[model samples]
Target: MWRLRDKYAIAGVGYTAFSARSSVTVRDLALEACGGAMADAGLMPADIDGVVSFHFNDSVPAMAVATGLGLPGARYAIDYQAGGNAANLIVQTAAMAIEAGLATNILCYRAMNGRSGFRLGGGRELAAHGVTQYTAPYGWISYPQAMAMWCRRHMIEYGTTSEQLGAVAVTCRRNAALNDRAMQRQPITLDDHQASRMIVEPFHLLDICLETDGACAVLVTSAERARDLARTPVYIMGAAYGGGPNQGDDLFDAMRWPDHSHNYARYIADDLWASAGIGPDDVDVAEIYDCFTYSVIMQLEGLGFCAPGEGGAFVQAGRIDRDGALPVNTHGGLLSEAYIHGLNHVVEAVEQLRGQAGARQVDGAEIALTTAGAMTCGGAMVLRN
Candidate 1:
C-alpha cells in the first residue's frame, strides 16, 4: 500500500568488528563504518546530503566527518529518539525525506565504545525510567535482571522452563560460529549454556547479550542509485512503529499494557505486521532482537510464529535452528554478537538479502523481517530484493 518503494533504498552497509574493546574511539568507529558504507555504495563523501541515527552518538565526531567527507550542502541532520528502533525509524524517515526532495543521500548509524568506554557496565543510573527507578535501583542492576524478571513471569504464568530458554542461547551460539565477524566465535553447546554462571535468578550468563565496543552504518538513497552501486539493493518493503492509544502504554513502561494482562510484545507484533502486509509465515529469515535469550522466544510467539504458550515447544523442537523453518538471528544476534542497540540485526538481514553472508548465509533469503524490543520499546522492518 505504501508507494515509496523505489523512492529510496539501502545502497550499502558497514560495521566495525564487534568486540569487547576495539581500541578505537567512537569517532574513529563512526568514520570506519561510514567510510566502508560509502565505498560499498560507490559514493564519495560529497554525495551525502542528510544524516540520521540515535541521539546517543557523539555529535561533534559526526559533524567533523561530514565536513571531511565533503557532503555537499548537507541540510537535514535528523535524530530519531527511540534507541534501537531509532536506526530503523531513521530509515523510514530518510525514505520520506528522499520522496519529498528534502535530501537525496542519507546515512543511518549507531556507534559506541560501550565495553571499553566504562559507561555501559559502570552502575545502575538508568532508573530515570519510573519503573526502572523503582526496580533497578533496588539491585535490579542492568539488563539480565530486568529481562530475567520478565522471563520469570513467563515461567510462572505459562509453565516455561530453563531448558526452553537455554535452547535460544544455544542456537544463537551455534549460529555465531558461522559468523566470523561475531564477537563470540567459539562454538557452544547446551551443556556449555547450562554450565555457564547465573547472572540473574531465572537467566544464566549465556542468557545475557554481549556488551561490546563497535559501530554499524548503512547508506540509503534512491533505488536508482542503489542499482548503480556494488550489489543488489535491498528495498524497504514495509516498516511500522507504534505505541500508546491502542496498547494503553508507551515503550518506556512495557509492562503497563492493560489488555491481555501484559501482552506488550504481541501488541508491537500486531502493529508491525499490519503495516508490512506480511506475517511470520511469509518471512524467509528473521533477525529478532535477542538482548536476552528468552526475549527471542517471547518475540517469536508475540509475532505469531506460534501460539503464546507454545514458544517453548517451538524452539525446543529446533524450529528456530538453522535447519528449522525459521532460521532466526542467523548472524549470532545480540546474545553472542555485540549489542549496538540492535542495528547489527538490521545489517545481518540486509546481508542475508544480498547473499553476501558467507558460511552463515541462508540458501535463498529474499524476504526477511527484523524485530527489536526493550520492554515498552520495540520496532520491526521488512526488506526484499
Candidate 2:
C-alpha cells in the first residue's frame, strides 16, 4: 500500500441549481461552477493552476475553463472520456497531480444541459463499432436497453425483485425530499415506483435517474494546504480504481458479463477498505451512484455491505434510509436529484463529513464512502472529516 491516506483534501464544493432546462451554454455552466468552487476556497481565479472534466466532448474542456476563468495557465489540464466511471477518476487524477507537485489547486467540474440540449441515451455514436454494426440495428443503441438486460439477469440469478429495486428509489426520493437542492423533492412510495411507467423491463420511470441541467465542481489541494482553507478539509482517505472483468471487444461478448450479476466494484472493495484503513462497518454514510435502482442494489452488494444475493433483502429492510444502517444517497443521488455525472455524490460526501448537510445530515458522520459509475470503468473513494 502506498498510503495515500490524507495526502489530498477537498477544500471547496459548489454547483448550479438543478433544473430540467437551462438557456446557458455548457461553457457558461462550467465557469459558473468553477467560480463558485474557487470562491468557496477563498481564492481568486488566477490562483487555480489545474482543471479537470469529463464528457463526450459535450462540456467545456480543462484549457477552456482555465482561459475563461483568466487563469494564466494550467499545469495540469485533462478532459477524460466516458461518463459515470470518469467521476472519481477526475478527482483521483487531480490528487495525483498535486502529489507530484505539478499543481497547487485543481478544479474538477462537470456541466451540461442533459435534458434540453442533448440526451445521452438518444445516440449511438459512443458504442463500439461492434455494437453499432450489430446491435444498433436491433434496437440495442441506448444505455437503458443494455442495462435492462443486465438487471433482468441479476434478478434471475439472485432472485431480486422489482419491488426490492423500488425500495432504492423510494429511499432516494425520501432523501431528496429533505434536500432543497434536489430536483425531485416530492416523496415517492414503493407503490408509486411500481405503478410508474416502465422504461424498460425490470425498470420503471422511478427506477431510472432524472435528466436535468446542472453543473458541479470541487477543488482539490494538498491536505497540508487545505488545512488553512475556508471549510473543514474533507481528507481523501483512500481512492481506488477498477473496471469490469472485461469489456468485450464487441457488444455480443460484453453482454455475457452480467451472467454472474457482478459489477467492477467487486474487484476493488478490498483495496478500497484496506487503503482507507477501515472496513464497511466503519462507514457512517454512503453516496452511491444511482443511475438506476438496480445499480444501487447491486453496488451495495459489490461494496460489501451485504452478501452477493442479499442486496434485495438488505435494502428492503430499510437500511439505506437516513436512520437506517447505511443511509445511502443522503442528497437524493441521480435517481431523484439532477444527474451531474456523480459529481454531486462527491459534494454530498464532503458536506456529510463536514457536518454541513443540514436536514439530511447523517449523525456522527466521521467517515463517508462515495462511488462513481458501475458496469464499466468505475472508482470509489473513502473520505474522512
RMSD to true structure for each model, in Å: 2.7, 1.8
On TM-score, the candidate that comes out on top is: 2
Give the least accurate 10-residue stretch of model 2, judged by summed lDDT.
250-259
Whole-model lDDT, model 2: 0.87
Supply the TM-score for candidate 1: 0.91
Error of 1 at 104 (Å): 1.0
lDDT of each: 0.76, 0.87
Report the lDDT tens digits of candidate 1 across residue range 1-385.
3456445688889898888888977777877887878888888877888777774433224455566567777776666555554656767777888888888888777788877874444454653575565555577566566567777777877898888888998889899999888888788888888888987888789888887788888888888888888878998877766433443232334445543222435766666666666777888999988888888888788778988878888999998988899999999998887788788888899999999999998898998887766455456778887
Clash totals, every prediction: 1, 0
* Overall local distance difference test of candidate 1: 0.76
48-148 in candidate 2: lDDT tens per residue? 99999999767778888999999987999989876887788799889988889899999999999988887887766645475466677677777777678
Q: Name the Cα RMSD for model 2.
A: 1.8
